[model samples]
Target: MEGLALILLYLAIPGLLFSALQRFLAGKKKSSSTAKFPGPEQYPVVGRVHDLDRFGMWLKFKEWADKYGPIYQTRMLNQPFIIVSDEKIAEELLVKRGHIYSGRPQIRSLIKHKDGPAYSALMDRHDIWKTQRKWCHAAMAEAYKHHFYGHVEMEMKRYLGLLLLDPARFLDYTREYCGRVMSRLAWDEATQGKANGESADQTLHCMSVSGPITNTMTPLWYLPAFANPWYNFEVKRESEQRAWWLNNLRLAKDRYRRGELPNDTWAYRYFEQIQREGNETLEQAEDQEIFASCMIGFLNLVGVVTISGPLKFFLMAMGLHPEWQKKCQDEIDRVCGDEMPTMANFADLPTVRACLKETVRWRSGVPLGVPHQAERDDEYRGVHIEKGTIILACEWSINRVPEKYPDGDNFRPERYLEPGWPTYQEPLTRYPNFREGHSMHTFGWGRRTCLGQNIVDDEMFVFGAATLWAFNSGPKTCPRTGKVIPIDTTATNAHVILEPSPYQMEFKVRSPERGKKVLENYHSVLGKLKL
Candidate 1:
């Protein structure tokens, strides 16, 4: 009798909750003025959750965009989402009227600390986000001016050496390159090894559990703590993440006290700034909040996995489209000439720049960008968007706009260089530059745009140029079949951040001289460091 009673109680809870949710949604639907917008047909309680794929939801979104025009609506349970594929709509809503559309959608799976203060800038809290953004901008600006180039160059050289040693491990080296550079910039050399790969695993794990399908299942959060798997997993990961952040923070602070860290490093700058401006001026005065916010905003959110996506795409592009690879190498040879390329040579290497731009457009890191929430009821094109409606600017669809990019499915660096393409411009020396507001929605839109764009651009540019200069990447030939090993450029991991499904390629040193130059630069940088 007790067992039956317990079973009945468990069943009754969800039934009662579902009834309440149905009533709430019915009221919302009656009041909603957004019915005029085209959308996929949604079921009663689940909304469109049944229609969406867990990992490949971005592809489904692109398909829906094609069927329903530029702007469309979908629901996940009681939450309404507005997906914008048109760049103009994105610009108008997310950029022009950013104040109304910059709030982050509340994902129940991501709510690890129910009662603790939100420490990530990714949260919806405006005041704390403002303070975090200001600190990030100031520190990044100072670092870029004084220290970022050296760190990137050092990492690029190390990356090249690692790739040359074991060409099959290019993907691993790409990840390591992004991780080490971010670690160095965030703290110092001492912390780079400890923070690089482990943080990446944590970030990816967090993203995996907090994706579209998991986010939509709001009922999971209402269950008892013992019965809730999502809540339990999130709690465990959050605790591990917090411990990692605190440990790194303690190490960095100890190093700072010893005068071992550079003044331009983000850790040094952040510590100095907080000490100068105490609790009265800051939103996050607690040490744990401060450390978590800095690390979460800078390293985990913007740095490692985000940068690795494009770099891997670039490598894939080289293997799949060797013609473009040769074009870029020829240009590098003409301009850089037997030396590894640097930011100083960026202006003269338009082909290299175009290839990098094309790679980003071809495979954006975040296909469906981080969702933004409407802060107030708003109207655009005679359509009403409610206060809490989630907004997604689908980067995958935006990049494939037929009118903007002809044959958008194919890899073509010439689109940015040729005369007639929509992306092209004159004055070859400066045309393909990312700094001139020519972004194709790669970073993001408006005030919420990534603060790490400058660093990302620099890293991509230098790494692309140096890699093209050092190695000739081509499709590997099978030993037995003798046929070319096929490259699947379309294959990607299904996380929110789109990473190429691991693939192999043949990376041969372009010339002995170039290989020697990479080795010399690696050793030279190593000698300069006291370690």
Candidate 2:
């Protein structure tokens, strides 16, 4: 009798939970079904997979977006998506109609595993996204534009000095700067200040989890991780790494409890607010959710490949093309006269700015950029696009579009100097080089744009200008004769991110006076940093 009763209880409990889950999902479906966008003529199960299988799908997406107009739809993984590429169309959906479109797409497996609310920026647009974005904006604004200028300048000086000493070590220097600057920001100090050894270790571990290791391994997702017995081992390895990352989060949580405050990171501010609210639920959300958000933000390192890639391209371009280097240095010398180029002097240094802009355009930081998934099925002209599709704007294609930018492959800063060019002279001019779909969508589009855009810009500009001012860049070997070559911009790869192939370069100091000045200010500036 007792055994029968236990069986009945088990069945009843599961049935109740299943019924409740069904009802919840049904309500969610009803709420989300209000909008319908255009899509390709494919059965629901197959969606737009056939259409996107073509070679150079990147270029094809822009062509389709133009043909389909704004507010189109498609599908992927049997999910509905909306695509908006034109500026007006993106504005309509992501801005004016933001209430409906702001919600991020959901990743089922990720959320099912409760991986702290899906890390894919392309997925999971919800209230959590809204909350995290709010905190991120505030944090970026506090650290980059206003608060962290001193640290940024110090790093810029170090980078400039390195250019004079060892050009071959450029990659290492760039990586160190990226690591240290990001580390400082993550740990909340102006420099390499550690609140505690465990906390610092936690930060490092969290970073390594998402670093190049995960990057190289992530493509394995294209293959089956489990289910197939042959793939089980790889899946287990990924699982182990994920577990380690979660443990690091727990360590961060403990540090928070111990009053280990971070002055540089946005997490500290948001978590503090959570604690101050005096609500146990909010406090929990603040601790866990905020930690999750920082992890997301720390994914900035993933995007560093974008910045570092282009910086090297710019350096190589300078090294190969000595004439352009001389022209830029002359302009810099005329404008700032060795005062260490500040943002205030940016306007006077238009030519210098143009070089950076042209560098970004010629060899964009992120060539493929983050892909935008369509939320609805929509059409422009006569193209047939379906819902739940993945669309790419292809920055390289658009930036190199001969019609929009004539002689697109050549590096010409003068084109932008014209009266009506996008970044032309204006009281409030935006940098043309950063990203171009709106604040240069190089960061991203719509609700999932990069939160670190401000710092990325400031650091790139500061570093680019400072390095040019300190030394003249040129290639060290000859291409044809196998002798000393010159750097050539056209040799860059148009991949996920545009970067110059490995090349040697020489950095010759423009003047002894400037060299001494950079050397004198380097350590003092670093000393002032609250490391």
Candidate 3:
């Protein structure tokens, strides 16, 4: 009877669904000493798998950190993971010991996908990662200079116009704005709008699913083919993304051969590298392919979702706190008057920038900086972290540490400006909030930090500044209760994105003159865009 019941359940449940239970059952016999560190006990195959949610597992680690102190150890699905919440410890591991700590785990999903090795953000640190990051670093530096896009300022004004017309579709506009900007930036004159939209939509859906977590779990990777809906979903989209990616590459390559591609954009720069070396061999081809992969992949995984999530949180926060909104609006009006917010004037409008910075700290997109894996066995502060052990510089917890941020959970931008508080040094931009001290940890640390941090900061401020300047965004009063709808910062969406749940907010034109200027800018800006 027991055998029959077991067989029946196996038939009913998919192999992927059974992966966690199977690992747990298989891990019953193994044990770990955790030595002197304070952490939950670890079993063989499952280790600390039981302690974490199969999705957004870092949140569970935060709960454990509350119990275990700043540094804690746990094993997930037979893989070991170390969580670092303190800045000092994070510096020792991710910064000082970066050689070993910079590596990304060799997750099966990142490996088997068509362009995974060449383009994935979650790639293990290797020659490819180094090569890809080096090129990306240069391109991103150019991209940070808003002038590089030629007509980016115009595009931004058009974005504001779109928002003013359809404030309710703010989320959709954000996705579209990033989609086109990235598409044009990557492909130059040749781009597929439908392909870009498809990539964004598919990747966005991929974000909402449990694809990443399920794939990284040790035992789950080997699940039968039929049970891999999560991996399969991402893989299919990647394949679709590759189609357009390869097409763009082909067009750019041909244009480069004819000396038609621009010098400033990534498309031209990548092909120029190839033409300079005069080595368009198989390896170079693969490198170019990976470059293409990285271009779309970075835009897809990092660019679109990164900007859109924070903007959502920014709107939610501004609505929840009216005083901040009014304060920012007054600052924007004083700084730019009837003109759309410009990066040049960003320093003068600190209040709007502070609100955006607070939103970043309050609910970061990648709360746990892209998971960095240990290259080999290493010890930090007497704790043993084995080779392949995953290390998360828990940005969520680090940003919220009470010692650094007083009343840490409270949404207050003023904390960063307070005297005697820890401050980070700003190099290229004047946004000290992101650069100085603990708050800067949102970009992660050491070699594995976010490559596009600068661009995200500038774009976020422009959007926030423009939105706050022309329109009023605040909590919408409930029709039934006759009370303002409460903003629930505590409630988070699935996966690593820490955005507030969908909430109601009111967005109305604050000034007809300013609003008219926005519409005029949109119309004029489109004509000015060189692209």
Candidate 4:
């Protein structure tokens, strides 16, 4: 009788907790039952996989958004995909339910690199991801306090010197500047004069486009390479690239071993932290090597690839809108005078900040923010989202939503200003000073937000303010016709990162004295940096 009583007690208490877990898991499954999930026509076998083959994923996704409204579901190679285009839906899924929406899709290309999948930013939520993110945040915060604006200013003014010399080669100039600064920050190595293809930035650009294309063919990743031409070629190519990057990573690691790399650099801190954990053991050594490889790719993604697209767009915005450009220059002149803008004085330059913010929103770089995965079965807005479904949080469509941003298509920074400016700010502007997803969704939201946002802000500010202070961007004249070269504001590059076309714009130095002063200041800053 006593034994029976004890069994009953145990079952009654512990079983209650078990039942509660069951109910919780049940709720997580079947997110939406009654609501209809909408999308374009899908074939029986291929589902909408052919859409990607026909047009870029982003372009087709945008096209479908118009037809199917904001929330839609489709399949790629028989895999479930949920695309969120509306701001409300994106916030609901990506922010409120970030825990279940933070997983990364299984992309073979991302994993094929020596330490590819180990890259915390691109990989799924794991212990390593959490650790790396913590380090990144701490590193950026420290950099923000000490070296943020001044370091980038050194790079930007140097970039301006190049721009002054050959404004027509803006493309190469931007690539080189981003490369040099990022190389210094990531590896503590100076690469200011590295040739175009040799710079780390150029390599990152080539790799950036690979992710999108490779993801679509993930269903074929494991088949024998001999059976697939594309697979064989990419594997060999990525292998070679990975080896080169890993060697570079080891060089940086060697510096750390010798106590040569700057202790302040994020990469250096990362290496030092792991080393302190007793990385002499075999497993720890392997982990260290993997992390070193991952960072090589991470720096490329966040440091170089992340900022280039919007940076080009920012310059294009200045060329297209000179009145706003003039106001920005006037504010910079009033606040900073002839001195270069530093992080210490950044608070005073709200106009430049707003302009930078607008550029991010206006021509958002990443349309579908690095696809995330759903970890569990869930329902939203009466629609079902199954476990392991791909989530494309569409930054492009959400930013363009007319309800939130009236006249959203235009580039207007005044919308970010407070109070009065009858023509530009407050009541006259829709969503005045509004900050969505941490000052526009360009950096993404929640767990996937940019690891390098501080760097992005500093780069945009230095480049924008420095250039506006020194030059006037206007339509270039056609040498043959002697007519103003028509600029195509709408022409853009392929999906993912939206880049402006090669538009005709002449950047004239504001004055010879100021131009000379800018170069002189650049030389002085570089000397102080010992570069």
The 10-residue segment with the lowest total lDDT in model 4: 428-437
Could you say which candidate leads in TM-score? 1
Q: Evaluated with lDDT, which candidate comes out highest?
A: 1
What shift in Å separates residue 248 of candidate 2 from its native position after superposition? 7.1
The regions of model 2 sitting more than 4 angstroms off are 1-120, 145-147, 189-262, 279-303, 377-384, 420-423, 427-439, 478-482, 486-499, 526-531
Q: For model 1, give the RMSD to the true fold.
A: 4.2
Task: Say which prediction, candidate 3 or candidate 4, comes out ahead on TM-score.
Answer: 3
lDDT of 1 by residue, 499-528 (tens): 788887999998888889888887877765
lDDT of 3 by residue, 206-240 (tens): 44324454454434434466865555666676776
Model 3, residue 274: distance off in Å is 2.1
- Per-residue CA lDDT of model 2 for 309-374, tens digit only, reads 667777776776678788778878888897788666665666666677777777666554455544
The candidate with the higher TM-score, 1 or 4, is 1
Write the number of the candidate with greater lDDT, choosing between 2 and 3.
3
Clashes of each: 0, 49, 4, 5
In model 4, where do residues sit more than 4 Å from their true spots?
A: 1-35, 51-56, 112-118, 192-214, 217-223, 227-229, 256-259, 275-287, 418-438, 526-531
With a 3 Å backbone cut-off (N, CA, C), the pairs that clash in candidate 4 are: 31-378, 31-379, 32-379, 32-382, 32-383
Candidate 4 lDDT by residue in tens digits, 1-531? 335433433444444456445644664663435565888776643467655732245667777888898989887545778888886777788889999898877655444332234356666787767766777678677776765535577777787887888899886677567666776676666463243124333333333433334444443444466644446655565566556556666777777777787765656766666657776422345556656666544554456656666778888888889898999899888988887676556667778777877887777777666677898878787676778888887776776776665567898787667543222443322332223223456667677877676677677767778888888998889999999888776566553455566676898888888888888976777665644
Q: Which has the higher TM-score value, candidate number 1 or candidate number 3?
A: 1
Off by over 4 Å in 3: 1-34, 43-45, 54-56, 113-116, 150-152, 189-209, 216-220, 226-228, 255-262, 279-301, 420-438, 477-486, 497-500, 528-531
